[model samples]
Target: MFEELSQYLGWTNCFPEGESFLVIAEGTDCGFILQHFIHTFLKRKLPVCLVSTSQTFSHYSQAGIKIGANLDKAREEKSIHLVDLMSKFLNHYTGQIECDWNAKNIYLSIKEELDSMEISANSILIVDDISVLSSLCLSIDDIGNLLHYLHALSKQRGFNILMSIPSLDCEQVQDTQSIAEHYADTVLCVKSLQTGYSKEVHGQIEVVKGGRSNCGVRQYKLSDKNLHLFARGTSMAVL
Candidate 1:
């Protein structure tokens, strides 16, 4: 499956080194895609740090599944760390209003935790719905700066960063995605299609970009506890 995607995107490696950004539309199986890629291709038994503002992690856990590594084993090994920013922020505050200082403090807390980890270059950091982070603490420009800083830090430490942005709120996250697409080594856009009058599910993907101009998008499916890629129609040249 990955072989087909690698060929379509002209990528030499399936899970390439450095930071990669992936954006998904709402209700798409973005989390599943990330989990499958890490479990199937990486071949590393390292922990996956999920930094999320939404209840995505909780939702996945409730579904009797996890993103990466065995949940029980990870818990035993103290590997998987689920940081719920919203909960943490609300817990730290007493008033109904939110403050920028409080938000910065949360960011610092996450940074400190990441700094303390003994993870290597193979470890993955999944920042689900960075749009929430942007809306909470910083302006659009500041969010871009923060993302650049995170990308640089990840590259320096040899860790991979996977971030998600919802397409429905694209205006709120367009700058973040644009910065990621330009700075990160790779960018993947996960999209879904509805076909026929009956709303039949047509296809989904992990469309790769930011290298070769004429590369084509590959079709990927996440079902039956597996992720596989196949040849699909080509997208516009990303030059």
Candidate 2:
């Protein structure tokens, strides 16, 4: 689904073990980025534990189908494990299950899911849009502590972590996002073009690996079966 993006980013090898990967989606949906990671890791036959905070399992399954990765089949095969926080939250709201929707409980649940997975260097943990925790009335401290715990877990288990968050206005949210970025080995910042939407390009992605010293920006357009990456300032519409 993201072969061009992967090749451009030199993801020939799996992501470095035990590193945090952050993606900040601003003015655009970064679902494709998350999907890319899942598809890539699963294609490599690596175990993936996806923590879906904002979307349901079925939502991802449908997206996976479009990308040629059958998430439902993967789950049946135990190749992918899902921590469906969205369903948990919904059940709690509808008086179905007594779920303590706090950061501690969430962290413990995620830890439990990761524990159930076959831990190895090739394992990948993907968290879709962590900032949604704020909507559950979690404090900034709670979010910070959650990230710290996840990072520690990754280090102890030797698996890479991937997380995405929308660019937000609240200072507290931004602080939490910054903390994630500081801990990240690679950060992908996705933002809309100033000139607004174009048939040629959807948005720009600024890739920061290790640090800002190593950064590259690319324009991209999303399709049903591909993510077309363009060199900075170039457009495929003309061709």
Candidate 3:
């Protein structure tokens, strides 16, 4: 999983069962971080559902192979499910469920799918970059409704809800952003380090609030299979 980084933001301390987390990453590397995160749970054979609006299922499949995850086995065992919301852009639909921006129906669809499959304590629902909510022309009210629905589902099923929402300042973005921050059990803010000097460090994160509030900032590097951590002045060789 996160290895040494787990002492900070990994599930070992960050995302416990039946909790909710909001991971805010301003950098593009959020996707890589998320891939490894998903791979970690799959490695543990936890039931996982990924609602993707950013990438196609094939992209995730390739990432699984890159990370050495038994994705095929996980799929066969019904341990992992990917819900693709972007495939329709290519005039195709292929996912555990084809999701839309409608709040109520989305929740019902997700609940129905999870119900039809095996779910357990270690189960988790990951919504890749909730920024898509606003990007898809959803209003603040719409986003709020969606968040509440997902939060309820998490509580009802005893699984965690993990979402990545970028920090934006527009009125509409601001409207729903606060809901995510306030609604989460933990918040992991991911952003690039403002190093006075350049280095290999990928980003910095902090548990600004929530269940694990006061967690300090830490820098990390991302490989296809791992998240490597380093302190200031520590050489990559130390990793």
Model 1 poorest ten-residue lDDT run: 194-203
| All models, RMSD in angstroms | 5.4, 1.7, 3.9
Compared with the true structure, the alpha-carbon lDDT of candidate 3 equals 0.71
The window of 10 residues in a row where model 3 has the poorest summed lDDT is: 88-97
Q: Write the per-residue lDDT of candidate 2 for residues 1-239, one digit (tens) a residue.
A: 58888876667564566777899999889998988888888898889999988998898899999878899999999999999888888888889999767778989999998888888886899999888887777788888888988988898888999999999898777887988987798888899988898987999888888777344688888898988888776786766
Point out the higher-scoring one by TM-score: 1 or 2.
Answer: 2
TM-score of 3: 0.83
Task: Tell me how candidate 1 scores on lDDT.
Answer: 0.59
TM-score of each: 0.75, 0.94, 0.83
**80-173 in candidate 1: lDDT tens per residue?**
6666676755654667665564335655766776876776777777777776755565677667667767777787888777777776655767
Off by over 4 Å in 3: 10-15, 88-101, 195-199, 211-213, 233-239
Clash totals, every prediction: 0, 0, 0
Q: CA lDDT, every prediction?
A: 0.59, 0.85, 0.71
The C-alpha stretches of model 2 lying farther than 4 A from their native spots are 13-15, 213-215
| Residue 103 lDDT, candidate 3, scale 0-100 | 73
